[model samples]
Target: MTGRLYNSEQIRDIEQQAIAEMAQGDFVLMQQAASALLGLLKQRWPCRKRLLVYAGAGNNGGDGYLLAAYAQAEGYQVAVKCIGDHALLPKAAQMAKKATEQAEVPLLALSAAFKADVVVDALFGIGLNRPVSGDYASAIEQINQSSCPVLAVDVPSGLCADTGQVLGSAVKASVTLGFIGHKIGLFTADGPDHCGDLLLEPLSIPQRIFAAQEYSARQVNGAQLLAQLQPRCAHFHKGQAGHVVIVGGDFGMAGAPLLSAEAALRCGAGLVTVLTRKEHVPALIARRPECMVHGVEAQQDLHPFFLKASVIVAGPGLGQQFWGQQLLQQVLMQNKPVLLDADALNLLTQQTTPQLKQLILTPHPGEAARLLQCSSKEVQQNRFKAVQALHQQYQATVLLKGNGSLIAGEKDLQLLNAGNPGMASAGMGDLLSGIIAALWAQGLNAETATALGSWLHATAADHLAARFGQRGLLALDLLTEVRTLLNQPCSG
Candidate 1:
């Protein structure tokens, strides 16, 4: 994660340096790396003894031939299906060719590789920048069609290791063995889908090797955040965490604001207030008397409530009523740090002018598409573009919630790879608003609060879904988990 991220050329530069500095034989390194991949395959798929290796004429194919030899030594039926003529291979690759010949492993054509138990795809690696066509393309398609699992070396062929773009066709790997550093492309765009269950090996390189490199492979892990946190001081009071005002809960949707207020209070926000329709006040107060419920029928009732809020959460179950719109407009006018969700996003689109600052807009794919004036399909196709465009246009931090749960600003973007599929259910977004608001009230700035808060909420749900399963998981399941995360002692 420390080294500068490299494209195909940079990877080649480092590989050459490693070969020279290590003073190891070129064939030895290739054989050793291939043996590691073979070991992983055998350990993971103990029942599979028949292995098919699809190889090209380059070094990637040389590694494949070395693996075929190891598989044969380990008593597995090994076959090296050479995709093209062997005359194009380099000297080191020819050494591998001699080893495969000495071992007497059968060299079959592309089509003949389909019936094996496991397929080792070494046809292409990071060097591929163009489309896969002709026989190689056909062979890749056939390999994908087979039921056997694939173990890809370096990266899935045809997938750009920088931008994660697919080059015409790409290999689908059940497990991709990455060497040296984890490529930044493997975590973004099409990287997640093409490279499955990625396992990185530093290739026995020391940590200092990355100091000379310039790119970044930043990963967001929740445990790291726990260590930097300070515990609650003895002098801390109930109201010390600050008051959070949650605006919304139009008429019949009282439960949304009520849930949000309760979640905030549980997350250590000192005072929680709910500004909702007049009719829903009594039931909310009755359910959670700890929450100070206000019967605000219009914008006039909002100013007094807004004045007491350290953080504001707008538009949870907030219908597009006149009161809802007026209340949101008044809150936006205050310019205090705000968490925008649900109807607040919808209401913003109605504005002809534009958005203001100090705001976090949490929008799903559909909402993101509307804000960008593009189709949802277009947003999904290039989500990084959509999120970046949204942040640039709106000048607000955006949490574009989906599978990867992207958090983007005007200058930076981080994808939260921790959220589970179970979080797709109801009231989840509202709960997220409460979490962000609580963190902001506790003195975290807008960006840190949003990033840390969103990660915590989503990650907590992921942990819960592990126990409850995704089918019936709900937002309320995260309440105790959030409290637990904030209250726990920080870890290194």
Candidate 2:
């Protein structure tokens, strides 16, 4: 719940420090890990009598060996498959292997076929820096193909603890038990896909040890936003809430700005305005009459509306044409808080603008790549780095949208722990931009607005997905849920 994420190296350093401080030494730490793994196995699979452990030649394999020994002592049918040369194991692993052998546990070869109620993956841990190959790779594939539930130790084998990129292929764990520190990779990119039901046990490390190391990123959820959300007083009027102007909806694309405007209104923006193509104004009002709709054809048309707005949600459907570019120019010229998405972001890539103090840029991988002049693949490879790069380049709060939405500011990096695949549908980003703009207009700082808005958007999507399933989930379906969640108290 602390939501601090560390890289593999940082975790290793913390572990070493913890081990050095403990009187029982490194083996005791290993024993604690084994005990925690055993406890989880017993709690999760009480009736299952068999446990198969896949161990490699490092400390990870040692944990599997120790777990096998403990399971054997507990009277379960335990089998350990050593994937590589047993002689290559480190001293601690050899000690665990010896303990397992002394307990009369069976050590099987990689080719041995065995069925189990549960499988523990200790093949590779956070220290893994190379691609899984040969017997190790084969074992991971077999584990994935098996029906038995898998509990990955520390980290799922073959997953980069720093970037969450799969090294060759990683084990898909039913529950990954992370120790010492939470790895940033487990919450981002491919990490979420491979690590199911992530649980951290910290191995009883003291808080001071963690305090000694800086976390790679912090996580934000709805619970953390509750204190910042104040209940409205009876005397409060609509005018007290700020007005949000959405500038987009060029020509054929009118739905984008409407979505943004509606979201803003739903999130408690006192008044919402839409400035788009002249022809789209009638439909915009018809769809949502609460929104003050204005039709604009020229730069001068938006000037008056721009002056009245407290915050601007730019570039939902703003095309990269002359009109969209002109609108973006006008929004950028304003000193008010701005949330830029879609074409506004695309237009940003075309021109250089002075770094504004109150700005939030929400860019998906492709859009981020465009802004950074890199490939989407590169952007995703290390999302933490990408978000940081964006912040440094723009000197603005950058929200990188993906599996784990990351917000990078001048001082910190935060990740959103909500959202699902159902949000992949169109108009999601526009809705998100609107929510952020609304919160900013309502008096939240740019950073708080970005974090809370991201959480609200994702949490609403999750709630809707739980009801109707992920497929056929529309962006509009989340508007009501967003209102409901915003009114509720924060659980954290």
Candidate 3:
């Protein structure tokens, strides 16, 4: 979990260097990887009786062949299937095929439809650069149609190891056992969709081997940020924690700002205020009496609140009309620590302002697309590139939310792997914006607040998803868990 993610070419270079430096042959490394795969399979399916291994014509196929041989020796019924032309296999794979034949394991044709307790996909690998078609596509289709569980070798076949884009079609792996360094693709884009359970096996490569290469990106786990949540002092006062002002909730959109304000309060902000449309005030106060809700019809109405606030959460439920624009302009003028999300992002994209520090922009793919003047598809295609572009353009801490939420700043790029599909509902982003603003108000810097807040928000959603299934999980479901996590001592 601590190593860096490398592209296919970089991983190959690392493997070659490891093999040369350790004097371990390619066959030895293949055997070790095959052993690791076998161990995981046995551990997961102790009573599995049959295994179907679909191998292509590369080192990946060689790993499958070795795994098949080992499974046969372990007294399981093993069948090996070759995709494409078997004669085109590499030297290492040819040796593995020979060993499988020597062991008398049946070699099936690519078109053969068979059933087994488990399917091991070795077709293609991380090096796949083109769309899957012809026999290879047929094999993938067959694997997908099968009811048996599939274990992907190295990476899911046809999945881009660098970008997680599917090459036309990709194998849906029940479990993907990665080797060497972690691939950045496995955690973003279509990666989380195809890779059901991802586990990395380092093949015992020396730590120094990784030191020779640079990491593509690092994941942001909550453990690293827990230290920032120092226990409050015994004599702490509510005013000392800092007040947060939430500006958004246009006409008929009071829930957005209300959610943000409540989240700020739950995250331990000293005091929370909501400045929204006049119509939403009574309902907001009725729902959360602790929040100081104010009805603002003009920029002057927000002046006092803006002056008193330590941080601002902007854009939740804020419309694209003139009222939201005026509020945003005034909020920007205050130069307070700001967490921009929802409609505020849309408004920001429409206007250009001076470079602002102490700003955090949380934009889901669509909002991010508007900010970058690109399509959501493009934003999702290479999220790393898109987030970095946002940070560079706006000079603010950026959190791009999706399957694997990415946080980008001037000096760091982080990925959060915590969240579930249940968080797809509305109000989640509002809650996240509030959490970050609260953290910032609580004296954490912009980058620290963003990193810690994103992790906490997603991890809380995950905890809720575990308790109650992923479906029907509301944004408010995360409040209790968020409070619990913030109060807990840092285990790290």
> What CA root-mean-square deviation does each model show from the true structure?
3.5, 1.8, 1.9
For residues 169-276, what per-residue lDDT tens digits would candidate 3 score against the true structure?
A: 999999999999888888998999898899999886788878877677788867668787777779999898899999999987899999999999999899999998
Q: lDDT score of model 2?
A: 0.89
Which parts of model 1 have CA positions greater than 4 angstroms off?
A: 2-29, 56-62, 82-102, 113-115, 127-141, 157-172, 188-195, 352-357, 409-412, 490-492
Top lDDT model: 2
Model 2 quality (TM-score): 0.97
> Comparing 2 and 3 by lDDT, which wins?
2
Which regions in candidate 3 have their CA more than 4 angstroms from the true location? 1-3, 490-492
Tens-digit lDDT track of model 2 for 173-290: 9999998878998889999999999998887677898888877888885676756877788899988789999999987899999999989999989999999998998899888999
Worst 10 residues of 2 by lDDT: 221-230
Residue clash pairs of candidate 3: none
Residue 478, model 3: lDDT of 93
Task: Name model 2 segments beyond 4 Å from true.
Answer: 490-492
**Candidate 1, poorest ten consecutive residues by summed lDDT:** 213-222
Question: What TM-score against the true fold does each predicted structure earn?
Answer: 0.86, 0.97, 0.96
Give residue 309's lDDT in candidate 3 (0 to 100). 89
1 or 3, greater by TM-score: 3
